[model samples]
Target: MTHIDSATAGPVSGAVRGDGLDARLVVERGSFRLDVALTAAPGDVVALLGPNGAGKTTALRALAGLTPLTGGHLRLDGDSLDRTPPESRPVGVVFQDYLLFPHLSALDNVAFGPRCQGASKADARAQAAQWLDRMGLADHAGARPRRLSGGQAQRVALARALATRPRLLLLDEPLAALDARTRLDVRAQLRRHLTEFEAVAVLVTHDPLDAMVLADRLVVIEHGRIVQEGAPSDIARHPRTDYIAQLVGLNLYKGRAEGHAVRLDAGPAITTTEDLTGPAFVAFPPGAVTLYRDRPTGSSARNLWRCEVAGLETHGDQIRADLTGELPLAADLTTVAAAELDLQPGATVWATVKAAQTHAYPA
Candidate 1:
């Protein structure tokens, strides 16, 4: 639960005159190799998002100097940290578990960083008190980790990390330890804290909502490589990968485009509003799809497919049907509409999506 301050180490060489993070992280582990180039300005919060075994954590560990880079370089606020040891890098890490010392009070936990940085005991305690106050936990300074609530403990951990005055902040699933209700409140608090941070912050998480809410930009990794990187809104609107489309609740398909029609790789052609050629991607939300018991007579939908209900599940207040047949996709409808259509496993259904509902972009 104790962390050594980077300030205790001598100055490193190769200090440049940059302002923020510039890293080309490359780490190889047997068959797995991660190569991702990342850059961010001061005050920017970037999220590393990926599924399990996708190298999100590996990238984070490399930045924190916990994992040695097999290639590439890491620079933060102008200093090259590629050769810096974990304790000598000007970085702060807020781990998933918070990792507060059980026997120490909240004040001592936050003071640990400054104390290691060569501050006097009184000065470190005073600095820790100020950080605890900024985190709105001044009253809990005397309490042990066991006495603090989940949200409070998270704040203490964040305060501990920030007390080091690090140029680069690394957070690994900071909200994953909390319950749903606690996560909502703590996420907002963390967002505010990140906004007030003057340096660069990098967060690693699998939750799309967390990445969207906390990060200014998103870097999505898959198979140890960056498949996509952009603003959350852009990524959500034009997901380039199936994993991203599913993460954003859209059904995606790749196809060859000709004007408004796209010939999908799955053997069906879908109508879209865009008029582009060559390879492209088509994406539509589940709610944009309408289901019919039988082929609707004289329907105006440009894209229609003969599908069978593969499965059904409750999604919020609606029924989400997983369909497979001529075109595999997902459809969300009201529970009443699902009952009216007699939706169930193996039920035959016709799915229709208007051209205007689908978004198409170059692959």
Candidate 2:
């Protein structure tokens, strides 16, 4: 119960740290190093969120002693944990792939942790059964990892990690393997379970939606350093990094505003809603755009630009196009629409956004 507390049940910020998992992590390997500090309270689900190679995984690995630290310290419930080995650390890790034994049934996998912690086999199985039931996996106890679905396997993984009764629980991209449909269901269930846990739980993910939905607070890292950290809602409202802004699907532009419109140094001039007279940030959602390869004769969209298609990636049934020219921006278009337009990299295109779609605020 040291990692999170019931007193913080109302509302709290990222500044809220408890007498649970306190970490000053510094791990160096050649040019790559991770220097980060954070704390998570009992029942507090803190997410380590960032893009790939942003040191999110490195930070988690360092805390569990899976990776050696060149310097810094870690403590759990006020006890120093500098020299603790991975096995000895009071930590339970649920890897992204679950890492469940394929041959063992769900019951055996959940029991393995407690058994390793010196509980009798019968006692371990008993405790494991209880954990499985709590995870809503009682019916799947006899199912093997291969037999279970991704969401079911994840629940088993959680039950196994929690069975050890570790003070600090760690999960790395726990729901990344599931399909979007399954992810939503699993994330809601996981949130409920995390809320009930009376200890610190830290989860790592690159998906902004997962981090926002699953954790009380977020600590974002990039290039081995903490870039931004705050409550999910706060960080979403005020993202300091362009990366964070882009991840949240905002059309962020660093430009100067003379009147109602702002001119992006890289590409386009946008008519904004905010009345600014100097340098400002103009942001719009990707959904706000209406695209046409040819310039419109009399379109309502006031902000128009000539851009070249840079790339395209699939998001569900939609194709997200990356454009370059007046400005580099990502646009979400349906796959059928993209095919109909004959869109490809290096193709010239015209993009437009309504003034209402353009939101301008102080930088």
Candidate 3:
């Protein structure tokens, strides 16, 4: 629960630190291509966040040198590593499934890295023991990978990666193997360990909560490209694309701005207080949307859209209504209000939002 600086703390995100990771990976196959640029500073944890098939794994593989890059540069601490092989690069990777050797004991699994790096058996085992102890797995050192629990195996994988003394750490869906119950605990432990790591670390995950909790900065990728990159809070507050907006649970629209009104590309105009020009984005919380059975006569709300309820679902204590028509948006209402309005799928409703509730920013 220690507080880490929430600034835009990555190489491509904000200001670049001289001694950090600077990479651009491009891979071209027969039909699909991936081109991603990433940067992070020492002591910074960056998460590659996106939906499936968004090239998160491809970028991670390129960074770990497991996949060859068709173009672009890879640098760590001012040293170029574009041509380095996977085994030769000063990098460590923890795969989604942990990828531990089933036959190897936890101690030996961790020791294998240092041993491969030319350390003596005794030295390697000693370092491995220390790492296990740091990971709170000292007593489980003799357990085989199959005998270890999901969280324990994850710690072992992380310990093995760190045992090599890597300058850059790459984790591909590090917690994807664990169940929901274990993921929470393991995520916390991983966060603490990552905070202690002085080297640059990049983790790939499709879970927004995981990315927000484990990383200081998030680089959201879609279709083999970076769509947005910034501090987690900033990204959450002002998502640029529909994918990002959906991930953050905000209603977003793109439009052309004139004074306080934005004419959306999809034929809906939203009124806001922002004095922006040219292309812009308008976003508001689902909770800010008010659902009415009939259009209000004296309501002060400026933005009103006649929408049909396409779907309804319970979200915690609130009911989420998915609407379509003039403006496609999501609205959150209390269970009591939903019952009073007799809300259901295919029901017609009027949605309105106060101008002050809508946030407009340059797109």
lDDT of each: 0.89, 0.83, 0.88
User: Candidate 2: RMSD over Cα atoms?
Assistant: 5.2
TM-score of each: 0.94, 0.83, 0.93
What candidate 1 gets wrong by more than 4 Å, as runs, is 1-17
**Least accurate 10 contiguous residues by lDDT in model 2:** 1-10
Residue-by-residue lDDT tens digits, candidate 3, 1-363: 001111222355443645888877778876667777777878889988877777888888888887788887788888889888888999999988888999899999999999999999999999999999999999999999989999999999999999999999999889988999999999999999999998999998878999999999988887777778889999998999889998999999999999999999977789999999999999999999999999888889999999999999999789999999999999999999999999998999999999999999998
Off by over 4 Å in 3: 1-10, 13-18
Position 257, candidate 1: lDDT = 98
Clash pairs (backbone) in predicted model 1: none
lDDT, candidate 2, at 248: 78
lDDT of 3 at 302: 96
Number of clashing residue pairs in every model? 0, 6, 0
Candidate 2 colliding pairs, count: 6
Residue-by-residue lDDT tens digits, candidate 1, 225-260: 777877899999999988999999999999999999
Better lDDT candidate (2, 3) = 3
